[model samples]
Target: MKKLLIAVAALAAFAAAPHSASAGPCGLPNQTTLWIDFADGSVPHWEMFAKPGVIGAAANFIYPPRLRAAGAKTVYFDLNFRNRIGTPSDPEDAATVVDRAHRLFDYAAASMDCPTPWIALNELFGAGTATPWSATNAQYRANVLAFVRTLAARGGRPFLLVNSKPYTGGEAGDWWREVGKVADIVREVYFPAPSIHKQGAVLGSRSMRQGLRRAAADFLAIGIPPSRLGIMLGFQTTPRTGGREGLQPANAWFRVAKLTALASKQVSGELGLATVWSWGWGAWSDGERDPDKAAAACVWLWARDTSLCDGPKAAGPGFNTSLTEAQITLPRSVQCMVGAQRIGQYDLARLTAMTRDRDVAYSALFARAAESERVRISSERILAAERNVILLRFGGSTSAYRGALARAGASEQVGRGVLADELRRAEIKRTFQVPQPSGTEIAAYYATYSAALARSVEATPAAPWLGGAKRGVALASIAPPQVFKLPTGRRTAVRWFDGIYRVRPLGAPKVLGSIPLAQASGPISIALKQFARTNAFQSWTITQQKAALRRARCARDELPHVAEVELASYLPFLAID
Candidate 1:
């Protein structure tokens, strides 16, 4: 009988081994998407937009080549259609204005290319505010569809953006209903706090959810599938405010997460693309700005965690929740002496490069670094000087001729002075020597390094998964046919045995009769024993036996005999099946 039991165990072990040996599940793929607007009436600081890592946590960018150079894979060009809208001053001029609008649309369509399979149609003029809300509704819809058709002609999906607040009495619902027919996906930009006065309003609040639901219902009503809708989660930072204002202190980060999760859940059960309005806005002064602060915030909010709501709880209800712990602690780290010095040196070098003549070697060095790194020279004064140099060397009607020449003449002197100052401030310079590690130590180090790198890349900004040196068994996939039978004419269900033995089959099952085991008196111990053991009963340790017996004694009335059967027979089944 023992030999027969061993054979049964061996069969189970073989069945389970294949499943247990499988590799870990693949980590979440990058789903985060970002959009920035650079096609307004005036171009923003183009140099700033060009900086490396300046794209923040955005996976996509929406600007011209100048702005898209910041490493974003997708660029959505803002077709500033509002500029073309007008009432002809004379009756004859009306046709000319209309003709001009058509030409502009054709020109823009020809000029741009969608970087990815999906290209967004930025409806800059669709909001009701631009044209009279009632009179322009049909016109707005037609205009947007024209652009979308053009995009489709070039083999790209159309993305539409709409204001969150009611536009000319038409809220998101109305806009969605009107444009839903043409757009492949609809994105709504929600600003919880329209003004500072409205701060602390529940953004992803119960009301917000209701509003979204209403908008969604309208879309559904208009035959727009829920799968095609996305919301652009963001907070507005005005020049008056310091850090991101309108963020609920308690729920700032949580709100962002909740909304992201909610939108993802609502849209397609997938976190659709999101963009933080403008990464470099807020209190960015040329000299005092820390670009990484904004970038870190962007990363923290968007790609840090897959689910926003799954993260740590906010401090309290109705409390501001957007400000993350990282954001709170940022003020302290923002002033890092060494880091700040490096940034300042980089900025100074950029300034010097821009001011110097383009023909000079030093100018080339600075321009190369700035262009390569995408660092924006924030100071208009510096940009002006650089322009002057470009004009002087290149000649023609250029912006800043004299300043570039003056900086070029003094480039060597300034470069030397800056280099000397930096070297003098270096506090510690040392070379360390150590004996080579043994093979075992070397193998362990490599393993540790690989694990750390994997975790770092996989870690979400929202809630990072941490690891340590302690040995702990990872819960792998649960085996199939989790139910089992014993020799005592009884059946039992198997489940993970931590401190408690959680039955896999929650209720009565057809095949397996209940076991007579009692609840575990204390933590139930389990481990992978020798593969040679035929019957798992032989591999069951004394502790496991004792715990099984204790749990059997306390088996509930509903499952009276669930503990008596020897669970050891099922040990091989514990291997992920």
Candidate 2:
């Protein structure tokens, strides 16, 4: 009868194993592997899994015997000596890993209940780190294969823990298939508490189950059998402890445990799968909270093979489960949509004005190439000029300019209108009877605009007019019909053209020799006159722009939906002042 049972077991194992060129079954029974970190025997609620004849595995070597003693059927040690082997391809490191494996196997072999422990050689290729994994590294692959074969030779079970999922193609596929042959592979899955809560209870649970199912399918696709595959669920807390607020509140913990059990069953099917590892239950580090009594209760409810946990479930009175994904995606009402549309239009107009102002400032400061002298311009002409300036500033691409306006919630028409008003105001300033600029103002303007005058002369040599004052010319020529038309010894600003000049009757024209104007540079008198005109125009332009803005009508009614939008928004409630 014993021989027949052995034959039946062998048949079952064969049936569960995948018929592929990969690792055969590691023969680990379906069990929970709890990774406990505290060595001082602060169990962190390990006794919850201590039901009579409850077979389980533990990652840390210190507590397997104690778990067995506490009424567990049989507990196996999952030795975790991570990264002790430096440069896995190195001969010395590979030897060191094998030596440690031997010692661990010997230690587990001494325990009566766990003669052959499942030793995790080490976790490699963590997905959350900057380290990149390459299966193409032949030496590393050879080292891993050698390590697992060595353990199997010693009659010990070896498994590998990895957070990163491996792809199945070319050399990568070859590596996973090779590793899956001798050892079990477990993947770690973690979901932050906030993320779970954001989805609500039911969907969160469903999402987690889907994640596990997908992982199992991925491994299966790479020719790994369900019997040899395993999963490790992370329950860590605090960022320092490598967790994003894991399973906070009593109910969240209960919900995760319940869903995890269901997911495990679905993934493992009927086979005795490797193990479901529970990581991060240790309080060894600061900010790491150990599992509490409620957590232990939930684990007990899930682990025990009894009908005792039906009475006090996590879903009690006042627990809300009505919120769902469907409810979250309900379309907005027509009224609200209309209100938002109106608000958006209002915002666009404001943005258009702002963009226009910015373009105007940019053009004034840097885009001097397109600027030309114009004493005055009509509203339509000014509008076209502003639009042209904006287009030129944005690389002459209408689409780019439109895209910028759209991003700022502005329309091109409104921007042009605002700029037209600005130009009109500047033109209007020239008509003002402004007093002559002081000598101090002229000197300051000369210092600030000497470079500009040089560039202008270089660009248009014929217009030796350095901002309205023509060099080496009779003062009488500065009369009507010229760029700067002003009476003798009298100054006026040409705000529209950004030029201000005063006539200076320095006597009648005379043939002062055939000297080039470049060589016969004008005296300080011509330069000072140019400086005065520029200073007056600039100062008056600034004063008028401010006055126009102050005097401009800003109708609150322009934004019909502003109050409605504010009502629809969170801005009012968020104000601290």
Candidate 3:
């Protein structure tokens, strides 16, 4: 009986061996698990939903000390220093900043003393900063190196945050190699811009699949093992020049799925851990709020067990064979689709269905890019609207000129017209209220009027026209027709506009107002409006006019118009006048 049982068992094992090996382990797929680095000190209420056993947190650099004390699992230290260094007042400030940052790190490490890993050493200053690496400034670099050496020496393994821009490659690579000599893991923080245009044509143009491939290659070149490296998805609100804004939060999950799918295609089996750019700080008005909720949703979607090895893993039929051959096999059971239905639930079947849905990937990419485009267009429209207002105020076109005054409201226009009439009356009265000038004077005045009228018609909305017209009228009223001398020692040939003097420079054949001066560049070139103010002549001068031009440029570049106008009052007399 025992011999018969053994024979039966052996037969059973032989028959099941092939099928059992083919079934694989727990249907586990070659998917990347999502982790979040909640850089903001505060945690959001929504984080409670993250997969209870798998979720990890990266506390803010300054606030992590408290978080560690509170028994948080992971803490991230910002390795770089903040505060301005080498400013005019503090040439030695860079050294001080570095020292302070190091001391802070040491204090945190000493206090925590836990065996749990220190996940990220978030080095600050990316492409936007003047300093690419701490080493760009020798003293600062030395301090950072010391801190890095300490981390390497300790049992803690740290990953460095890197920017998308390639500008810091040399410094980053050098640091990585030098540090790797001692550190157990030298991982990188990758923030690839989602949209092709935002990332610029070169990086973004690559298909999600292609981008991941390149990222893998780039990482390998930098000496990071495929297993050790991780990718971070960022949630940025601002759009590029041609991008949109306010993307649906759901789209964030879709993007992650797409990136993960691509990453899976590049590497065989389970790729290393993945992290979202943030967790928490979602409730705070600034930074990404609801990050916890978003992160929870992403992890719930990605944690499903499915294989990527069962399906025919080609990049499709006629594509680059080299690229195709590199494609990683995917399991038909793995779901990559994302939608409203499966957002919060961590159920297995629903997740698999979402991941496999091809439409979800396409829709997600489209929506994210559209949101980015909307932001870009809206910003441009606002800027154009402001330029339109400025042009109307300065250009001498009757339409724009009238429109500007009208927009200023009825009271402002009425006051300006009344003041101009009073000035005209005063001038006529000073000449004994004469009904008419002598025939010779009349001909000269008429000629001046013709020239002035021409200039008024030809004037572009700009500062020079306003200032020139005011000065010409003043000179014409006080001096003889053709040979009036300006207060600035320049001679003017006069013309008249409704009996007011208009002047032109003598040497320049072109009418003075019509002659485009090099100095009169940009939208609102002269201080015409200032000349209309009380004590007009005294208030408007070359120096004052030039200052106004500068202010206009500065205002357009900096503050919005409403704020600019109010701030204008505080500017130097030259700018305001």
Candidate 4:
């Protein structure tokens, strides 16, 4: 290894003649940087950095020329060193640091169109070693600063990494400010993966953002400008092997990953900091290995700027639930976010499904809202009692319930609100005031619509031995109502009672004409009951809901462009399937 290092140094010296560095691909001060650590020459997720959204990737240990050859723009050489080079009395120690940096720069320049300006000097201060303020580390501090300054003197932008804040007073703060003048000062801020996937509201993930903001504030308080500051987030493991449980159940992790990008973007835009850097894509220790790193990286890219790549598709509920290529538009409402709970286009789409006319949809929305309010007022105690029963169905595991809810695009609060609406609708049906049709009325109705009532069933051979034969089965032979709702010519995967064949509708269903009163009585009775309840529910609430709508003050804005988004953060708890 020593011989190899010496040979590389000799080669670097031969290539050290200064050449004008070419312009890098990334336009800085706006775009983020994806700094990944690889265990070996082989990059498992090479496709992640094969584009131009980020400021290019800062790689560790991987040969710069190899990465560039793979079509990745290698922008930074990530060097991990945690201690001073030599004793204070060693005159060659400071010179050694400069010489090493030059050799690395030359080696990187050999493969690039231009020399990379960025060099991430990672973890220069060891954990619990002499603090920046400690007198015991004066020489240590001087050597580190010399390394940073030397890199800067050669037109290189070196970012110094510290495990944590290493200062106690303004004196150390002054020192950091001096270092910041020449190089970026970054800190590693990591949270256990399990914490991000916790149950309930997104408080855990929100707390993570809050932690970042607070850390940034601390640096700013110590006189470091945001331009010279950065933070590194750790994505080190999957839940299975790491000592610290990583993000789990896939959906929750993806949600957090996307949110983390948004949160970091918010902080950077608000605070003017250098971009956040990502770490832990390598096959390192158990705590630093993530199997889903590729997907996570894609999500991060998509969240920052959609032009980079289509994000991972998440299967959930509501209109446009497929997120693989969802083009999100802002929720179109003046008061969308003004309520106790934010209203989204998802809710608007549900209302639209109920009715096509805007007025009718608004009426239905108000009716449901009023019913929800009434349920909350009159049946709060009952619902509260059912909460435990509902939890018991998930084996009392809040995490499982939350994970299930996340997959369904609902949080516990939304789930409970839906439950209340369901209960109110059920009660309305139970207490419906419609009188049953008289025997004469039933007979006349059956005679008029019998042909429309007849169910249609087209049969397809279930076994290969049947030679793929298909035939229309007699309507009378099959049971009623099962195939009644099947659309015309729509093939259904459902099997028949004997499982001998699958069925579909060969033609639109027609009423059973001239059927016996006995056979027609059951179908007629069911149809009447369903019609009465539906009519009564709509009419009964329309007038009262119109009055409520006047006071509701909902936005007059039209529905937003239909799109789907990951709902893990929004609906953290949903009923288990």
Q: Whose TM-score is greatest here?
A: 4
Worst 10-residue lDDT window for candidate 1 reads: 519-528
lDDT of 3 at 47: 36
Give the 10-residue window scoring lowest on summed lDDT in candidate 3. Answer: 555-564
Candidate 1 off by > 4 Å: 1-71, 85-137, 165-178, 184-211, 239-243, 246-296, 299-577
Best by lDDT: 4
- TM-score, model 2 to reference: 0.44
Model 4 lDDT-worst window of ten = 559-568
Which lDDT values do the candidates have, in the order given?
A: 0.31, 0.44, 0.33, 0.51
The candidate 2 region of ten consecutive residues with least summed lDDT is 559-568
Tens-place lDDT per residue, model 2, 1-577, is 2332233233222222222223222333334332212111333655554544344445444565665566554334443444433343342244455566566667656642455555654465432222234332333444555556555556556667777655556545655665676677777766664665566544555556567767766778877776667776765665633334644565655554455444445444433455666655555565565444335334434432334233134344433323221111213221111111111334333542544543333223111111112233456675555445444355557777677656654566544534543454344433445455455664554444333312111111222243233433432222223322333343333222222233342322333233233432342244455445445656654444333222221111111111101110111111111
484 Cα displacement, candidate 3 (Å) = 99
Model 3 ranges off by over 4 Å:
1-36, 39-43, 49-51, 60-72, 77-102, 105-119, 126-140, 167-173, 182-206, 238-245, 248-328, 331-577
Per-residue CA lDDT of model 3 for 1-577, tens digit only, reads 2332233233222221111111112121224433444534344532332223223344444444444444333444443333322321222333354344345446445544444234455542342223343433433333334444444344344455544432226555654444444332322333333453243221232233444445445655777555445544333334341111333443433333334434433332344433333422234454334333444333323432222111112112222212222122323432211111111112232322333432332222222222222222233333333333334244435455445444433222232322232333223222231132244543433444434411222111211234434332222222333333333334333322222233434332233344333222211222222223323322222233233222221100111112111111211110111
Question: On a 0 to 100 scale, what is the lDDT of residue 446 in model 1?
Answer: 37
Ranked by TM-score, the better of candidates 2 and 3 is 2
Count of backbone collisions in candidate 4: 14
CA error at residue 143 for candidate 2, angstroms: 2.8
